[model samples]
Target: MKILITGSTGQLSQALQTALAGEGKVLALGHKVMDLTKPMQIRQQVRLLRPDLIINAAAYTAVDPAQGDRDQAYAVNAIGPEVLAEEAAALGVPLIHYSTDYVFDGRKPEPYHEEDEPRPLSIYGASKLAGEQAIQAVGGQHLILRTSWVYSLHGRNFLLTMQRLLQERDTLSVVDDEVGAPTWAGTIAAVTADMVRKWRTGTGGPSGLYHLTATGETSWYGFACSIAQNLERQGLLRARLEPILSADYPTAAERPLNSRLNCARLQRDWGMVLPDWEAALHQCLGNANAHQANHSMQATQSL
Candidate 1:
């Protein structure tokens, strides 16, 4: 099958490329190739590609900056998916889109299920929620997978940010009040590929909103501490970690304190379960170490 995936250079897209390797023809388009903010461009590309499946990973993800730039966020995160759904309905193909856990107000004591009401706190979250609703309104076969605290080594994410700060500073502070699973991009990509494969084979269950995240949850401070401990074990760096409340570090956007999502529905329907956040983190760090070693060997060969 021919597949069209947006956000070509993003961490999730890169992982999707790897996961979908040899499965089918994948037309990966980045912002340079197809800007989500431009509906005509999106419509044109969909018409031209005429893909059997559309996986929209592209999004405007700047939480704080989104407060000042709601137009851009809504254009990419809301209008983009709406246009894609309309085109997909026209072509009679399924579209896979991603949402965020930020849609919730974080008031619930337990993990959020798909049926939970969404009350987004930040403009970024609101825009994403709007995209989900827009896609549903188009009356197309689509899957809106809601994930939380996603990070990976290949892109601008929490894991990479922690790595950089650990190297640069002897001390670091991270928010402890907010909690969520630090999902790996690779995990999302793999599960997405599985879903698409099953759907193509007429085995995939159904299309709807599902919470896709790691099995366990942790605060930003805990996540940073884990990364620091892992890096230190690899002889990378040693640093003093400090945990602070969310108010201690204010931002333009209000973040949800409880970003945890329950994935029981995903597992029941897809017959798949993701590893814990810590295990995924270990695998990511291992990959990073291997990449560094390869680079070092290449340098030595050049010398």
Candidate 2:
């Protein structure tokens, strides 16, 4: 089955590309190839690809920047998916998309279920929720997976930020008040591929919203410290780190206090279990190490 993935260069898209390479045909398009900002571009691309499934991995993910750039965010996160869903509906294809845990105000005491009514805390969350509404409104075969605190080998994410800061600075402070699962993009991508493949088969079940995240939870402080510990174990520690609350690390946007998502529904329906956040973080750091090694090797080869 031919699958078309938008946001080809993003972390999740990169993971999906690597995971789905041998399984089936994946047409992963970047901004240059399929600019989602333009609705006509999405419509034309969907028509041309004629894919069985269109996984929209692209998003306007500048959470803080989104506070000031509502138009750009709405175009990419809200209206862009609306256009994609319309075109996919026209072509009779399943649309798989990603949402965020930010949709909730983070005031909930327990893990958020798929049925929980979304009350977005910030503009980014509001925009993503809007996109989710659009996909659902289309009434097509769609799977909207809401994930949180995503990190990967090839992206501007928390893990990378911690690693970079650890390399450059002598001391660091991270927010501990905010909590959520540090989900790995690779895990999300792999599970997505499995879901899509099942859909292709006769056994694939209904399409709806689900939460896909790592097994456990941690704060930015704990997550960063774990990375630091791992780096120390690897003899690469270079920075001193301190744990602080969300108030210490102020941002333009207000972060949810509890970003945990309940994946029981997803696991029960899809028969999948994601790794723990700590394990996922280790893997991301490992990937970063591998990437650095590759770059060094290429430089040596050129010399």
Pick the TM-score winner. Answer: 1
Residue pairs whose backbone atoms clash in candidate 2: none
The all-Cα superposition gives candidate 1 an RMSD in Å to the true structure of: 1.1
- The deviation in Å at residue 215 for candidate 2 is 0.6
lDDT of 1 by residue, 27-85 (tens): 99999878999999999999999999999999999999999999999999999999999
Candidate 1: misplaced stretches above 4 Å?
301-303
Candidate 1 collision pairs: none
lDDT, model 2: 0.88
| Residue 209 in model 2: lDDT | 94
| Weakest ten-residue segment in model 2 by summed lDDT | 196-205
> Relative to the true structure, how large is the alpha-carbon lDDT of every model?
0.93, 0.88
